[model samples]
Target chain A: MEESLYREIEEIIEKYREEETPLLCVLQEVQEKFHYLPRNVLGYIAKKMNVPSSTVYGVATFYSFFETNPVGEYVIRVCKSTPCHVQGAFNVLQALKRELGLKEGETSKDGKFTLEVTSCLGVCGVAPAMMINDVTYGNLNDERVREILALYRR
Target chain B: MAKTLKEMEKAKEKANLVTIYLDGKEAKVPEGITILEACRMEGFHVPTLCYMEGLSSWGGCRICVVEVEGQPNLVASCVTPVREGMKIRLSSRAVREARKTNLELLLSNHPLDCQLCDRNGSCELQELAYEFGVREIRFGGERKTYAVDMSSPSVKRDANRCILCGRCVRTCREVQSVCAIDFANRGFDTFISPSLGLPLGESVCINCGQCILACPTGALSEVSHVEMVWDAIEDPGKFVVLQTAPAVRVSIGEPFGLPAGTVTTGKMVAAFRRLGFDRVFDTNFTADLTIIEEGHEFIGRVKKGGKLPLITSCSPGWIKFMEHFYPELMENVSTCKSPQQMFGAIAKTYYAQKMGIDPKDMVVVSIMPCTAKKFECQRDEMCASGYQDVDFSLTTREAARMLKEKGIRLEEMPEENFDDPLGISTGAAAVFGATGGVMEAALRSVYEISTGKTLEKLDFYQVRGLDGVKEASLEINGMEVNVAVAHGLGNARRLLDQVKAGNSKYHFIEIMACPGGCIGGGGQPIPTNLEIRMKRIAAIYEVDKNLPLRKSHENPAIKKLYEEFLGEPNGEKAHHLLHTHYMPRERI
Candidate 1:
């Protein structure tokens, strides 16, 4: 509800005013700016675009990439696809969970780390892949996963 | 394909006919039509579930799959267009087996508790299961179970019983344009839910219950008040009084095996009497009273330079829609309480005091053809007489079910009139069930009162029928009063948007939330589509024509109520009891 946030949202909405399918693009930009889609911001966008709030919420929940809840300072999405599973992705997931002291989709108490198990990150050639923020780490083992977490912690 | 001699004889109708083989018989049909339409034209009955008549075809449910020649896979006939020389088989051995497999998969995830469901007999999915003779589940699997949502006073949502057909989702978005609910999440976890998975009561749902009518199963239903009514009736110290809405009299017979639109008013009353109600009254009496209040409000607004266009507030769904979407126009809406609430307010004060019955012990039950009435009766302001104005409200379907549970056949019961005092209503009250009935009834009284001359033709044909939006102009006392009538929330939105934009040029408007007014309300009989709604509208008009007193102002009981109790139409006591207020709501 801050003045700056309102002005920024208005600017984002204005940028996609001419696009054919602007809702998802507008939502992605908003999410990128705020780390997640705020509930009140979704309602604001619906009012701005003359669309129902239900529709904005529907599109927001339909895509897994968009998060409605706030993420931690660092998000760890371990790949759980077939190729990664064959390469001991479960061990990598357990390592990350133990290192961050958080279960899947849970943020740590200090809000420093969050762990999630996602589908294929499309780096199956290297297998046992994981994504932190936007960086992808492949051929990951238990020790390498802990080392990656330590690097982020520093 | 082999061309039969009899098929050739049936194909010689038109010169431009296209030839297609249907079930190996060479038949000629029209060009550029879907295979389902072509098959239907050929006198073939192809079963369908998700394919509604007016909606855009969604081939989600493969129950209507048919075998086509040279096609490797069976095609959904509802979405596939027919081509010239296309050979189609509606019921082949392979097609039947594939349909059975598809249904088995749906049933595997579906909970098989039809006996305990609300839509047990009337459900489309249940009927298809019976047709397929699904005895045992060949493909048993883990079923999807969800907690039932009963937060809304009007609707109840059970996600476990949903078939993921998207009928309710489409109906909410396409027909009503409320868009309060939609398909959320991805495959396997996909279910129909309100926006952000909020309870329907918290969402911008008008509680229209059209989704309940569109649902193919028991996933969506009205929040029932049947048991509460039964408990009140069983209490020895309580005097239970019943009031049936005007729309209920015309459509309540559908669940009792009588045809749609059958006017079972007399039998409905008799059934209520047999059900142990001490008094059986009519909501039409208060519907007439609404005319007096709303009509005066309109004239006052026009004369005093108040809000130009006065809108009717009979429908709670429409009232909520206006509150959420068009809050700026709240002043345009008439403050008159709906007939159901008006009847309750009068029943507790005037009727109870007359009979020397204590208001606390008098339980007023309303049998309405609407689900929103259930929510309307529970509003915080409805208790104008210390006790709750209406103790309970039951839908037409619920009332019929209670009658059947008591072993009472509506058709077998003899004709009986509504009880005295509160039961007497005029023809103007009877037409309140249809879409334009409110506008016509108001004009019938308003025109006569203003001009001091009777209307020769009581029927205002211009404002009648199933049109989504209807407009008419009347000259009362040399003043041109332009009026419009809109039924269905989608149409109401369109009309209201025009009004909000300052483009509307009417002095009065009538808006009903359901498509064909209260007769086609959300809680009406199952299969309440366009055709059935039209029949109910016709029956409403027929009831109007047969009555001797055809104007609200001429109703002696209403006149006596004003003479003895409430002094005038918009008097201090009348406004206190008969009028209500509205508040703006969150758009989300």
Candidate 2:
């Protein structure tokens, strides 16, 4: 399995070898091929490219675009920015706490949902918002939050 | 109004102070202060990566996470304000775990090239990663790749190591008011970039480097001349002459395990010698030359009606700022190159002529308390003698690192003097490193020259210390020399704007890029913030007060140099070797 994954990564690298934005393309390809970018695979890519692992790591870490850790089956992110806070995101957060029986920034015991608080979601017009996986839910209320969480539950 | 605890105390009944246990020590703190602030007030040194003084708190790093009684998750003390009857544990297992996890997350993205990193030993991120005992990053992924932006003369930006603390963004907008950089994108794609994707040098960056100081990692660092300097030092064929700027003596001590403001002049001289430099000179000597040239230039401008409000051209940061933000004000800046560059030009020509050494073989290295000096040395017109005047420039921190790498113990070394004529400087020149110092020093020299009478009090108390903007006037030779001093590009802009609006006019102006001048230069040392800058500024004044010759003209070595080599101040010989012209920057 490891050899196959390595070969796949190498093939992806070859496809993006002459691309102007090789790193970006390679990152996307790896993410698609292996659900999450693995540490060994990144190391292998870095070595194959003859680039410093740190430079590669720094690039991976600098942009919020890449995720090092794997998310649960469903990832839930709450907007705790100033505008959202002013619109009572704390109450929505409490509602999430009660519904999931889990605190902020924790994954549910059943591994159905993982919760987090992000900076601004740039949906200030809607005020409080949450993103389940990649889908964003805006103007969240207690009832709406429960209804949303219920859909993600196993 | 911000409604701080101290401010609220005067308006109403004093809010009861709460006692909190920090690392087993009990201390009373104001009720509304954060646990970090409370612990810091109590003198508990909790290592934090993302915390900064006088900025909106953003607990993005989670390095300052602390255990609070009744809280389920570890809280960022920086953002979490203190509450009455709140029990806090700073270094608890859970707190450590959270901090460790956060650091590991940060490290998973961090590049591991510490040796090549400019911030190497002094980086907060590197220090924390070491402290957290993160042997390996359990989770790693695709790294971000961006071209190195070396377009800026002063600062180099590496987005890879950036933790997105927004300190640089906040500092640029709030402190400096030069909104050159901002968060360009959202979510995972988010990164700080100049507006409209302009290169930093082309943007209205002002070259202050406050953002570099604000950045917690090697993501932002001064463009270094270490490799260039090391190469020169290694080549026995080259006569490497090193010059240390005045501000360096006070601030360089911090990196050497000495307290901030500890003046290590003798040790600095010793370190240069130990670094295998052929000669160790003082920028203060040329700083004295600057006064002679700049003072006469100011008087010449005033007498001839050339340009009123003749600004000091010593700060390269300010020079760059003028070129970018206030291109119209370029004519107001003095034609003289900075003291460090002046010394470099002279060392290659005048010093080489005196020593009977070939100018080609002479390698001039300037040790300054400035990152801007790095950009200054690489200027096209700086090479007056058919060779680059300064082969390389080292910051006070870099010099300290070189000393450490060479295994030289500065404190244990015997007191040494700077080599011959070039090394000499007066007290007035020494004070040029502090805020308002150049204004004060130039005033002392200009006042004496103009009036033909010695001033009783050498210190210009009005222009001294760490205020952002300082204004003063003195009647010299029956003419009111209206003067203003500004440190940090933010303050520089405010003062220059007033001048542009025709609100005020002055005979002389002093501006340093970093707050508190060279003593607080971006390249001085890690933790080069306001408090440390103030301490170094105080010590600079103290050094000035203690010296016998408080005026530039009183320096015997300078007088001798003029007598033996150069005929007079700003003379034909001096102009050829000491003075330099400025170039108008093409719009970025």
DockQ of each: 0.63, 0.02
Model 1, CA-based lDDT: 0.89
lDDT of 2 by residue, B1-588 (tens): 123333334433465787777776776776776777777666676778767875677787788998888889888888887776678888888888888888877777667788988778778888887888888878695677777788887788999878788888777766665666777555565677764355676665766677888998888877767778888999989999999998998888787688988888888788879989989998999999888888888888888998879999998878877876677787888888889888988888778989999999999898888887887888888888889898788877778878887898887777799998898888999999998888889999998998899898887889987678898999987787799999877778888997787676677889888778888787778888767877898889877878778899888987877888789887788787777666565332
Q: Write the per-residue lDDT of candidate 1 for residues B273-328, one digit (tens) a residue.
A: 99999999999999999999999999889889998689999999999889888999
Alpha-carbon runs more than 4 Å astray in model 2: A1-154, B1-35, B43-47, B66-75, B81-94, B113-116, B130-136, B198-207, B568-588
Clashing pairs in 1: none
Please state the CAPRI-style docking class of candidate 1: medium
Best by lDDT: 1
For candidate 1 chain B, the 10 contiguous residues with the lowest summed lDDT are: B1-10
Residue by residue across A1-154, what tens digits does model 1's lDDT show? Answer: 7989988988999999999999999999998899888888988888898888878888888776677788888878888889999999989988887777788889998888878877788999999999998999999998888788888988
Q: Candidate 2 chain B, which ten residues in sequence have the lowest lDDT sum? A: B1-10
